[model samples]
Target: MSHSHSPVSAPATNGHDLAARIAELLTQIDTVKAEYATLDKRANEVAGQLAQRFPVYDELYMSAATEYNRAQADLARTKQADTEPDIPLDDAEKASTPNQAVRSELSGSTHNAPISVNKLYRRIAQLAHPDKTDDSNKHTLFLEAKEAKKQGVLSELIRILALLTGDETRPEQLSQHQGQDALAEKLSRINVLRKELTLYRSQLMQLRNSPMARIVDLISTNTTLSITKAETLYKMTILQRVKELETNTSGIRQDIAFQSNMNKT
Candidate 1:
């Protein structure tokens, strides 16, 4: 069995301490998820308020935008279809294109994950013993465990072992093999959480930079600004965009109608 433990800084840190660290990390990740949700809700609320003030126009503007996008896509597709027959790929281009390139790659050797050893993997090996796989799923679980161990991913092994053995194994129960594998699993989870946090923050920043969010911030920034005044300010800003979309949508519909007539002729 491959040991798939991620390295926890102190190789000797007891399983109990590692579990505590894992708890702290999960709590922090959940907090970040909550923070992102709050800001997303705020941005949506601002949009809703604008829609409420301009109910009819709001619907028209959205409908028009969708129609405009669809027409533009259709136009592009039509142009491509009309011109594609005149241009044939050369020998080099044909070899590099999907039909040839993808087939060539598919005929090569399959890449495999690296393998290491761990106690949890040992436990998985025992539980998923080939001789005792009458449960049908046991063999599948064994393969998954083997793969996880090879990948040095103890967390996946832990999950599979729990399913095979029907035991709710906690982080502490996995303290075997000198706390190596479990510690690695904790670090893996932490690294994943850190990446998730970065992604969430980036999304939040994008929302903040959007026109609707900026308008909301601007109206709310003045502590003395009256509720009526703020409402008016939001409506005034969106009204211009709504008019622009209306014009664009009209133009797109006209173009689409002209194209349809030309196609028939």
Candidate 2:
């Protein structure tokens, strides 16, 4: 009774067991945290893929929509133009007017390549000659041809006109053939060609002033803008040709002045 039975060692054993249980629980918690981190990373990757795919899908849809709208607008415009009433042809007026020649040349050019300018003028004169019978169709054709010849058909129209008129001269050989009769014919054709050239110049100016031309300029100036090399080359060629023509004309003028002064002396 005196030495109270030494306290049983059970409490110590129980404390050791409790500490072991806590360490096991902490290890399990760490494992769960690692698994959660993995899950979070996978979820983020899936979200990024969805975001990237949706924008591209939407852009494709928008592009398709724009194309469809453009097609619809073009269709509607074509239909409207088709439904309009046509103007009746005036037989006598058309026969008397200069436009008849133009119409004929336009039709002929559609069927064949452009005729030479000298030839075109000759053919027109033949058709319009007073000795020819007064055929309304022929008259209209002659006038149109004359008008077209005048506009700048000299190079191509002349060839066609010369062929029709039974003339053998080509544009390049014009200066060599200086006989009075040849000069007269050449002078007449030159006048017409000048007029046509003026109209073409006007058309070129109109194109230069167009919004499309502005866009082309923008594309040329901006490094990031998309444009084909061929288009740029074509524009350059056109400009070069214009410059060449101006130089040639200036030389011709100087020659004419020199010839005139020599003749006067």
Winner by lDDT: 1
Instruction: Put down candidate 2 lDDT per residue, 1-265, tens digits, no spaces.
Output: 3765567743343334544644555454445434433333332333233325444433333343333334434433433344422222222112222222212221122112222344445546555543453767455546666566558544445434444455544434544564345454554454435434443444344434433344345444646534444234334433443455356445545554555565566
lDDT of 1 by residue, 137-159 (tens): 78788888778877877447656
True lDDT of residue 150, candidate 2: 58
Candidate 2: where are CA atoms >4 Å away? 1-179, 223-265
lDDT of 2: 0.41
lDDT (C-alpha, whole model) for all candidates? 0.53, 0.41
Question: If candidate 2 were superposed on the true structure by all CA atoms, what would the RMSD be?
Answer: 40.8
**Can you list the residue pairs that collide in candidate 1?**
2-116, 2-117, 3-116, 3-117, 3-118, 4-152, 6-184
Instruction: In model 2, state the lDDT of residue 102.
Output: 19
TM-score of each: 0.41, 0.25
At residue 117, candidate 2 shows an lDDT of: 49
Local error of candidate 2 at 50, Å? 30
Cα RMSD (Å) per model? 18.3, 40.8
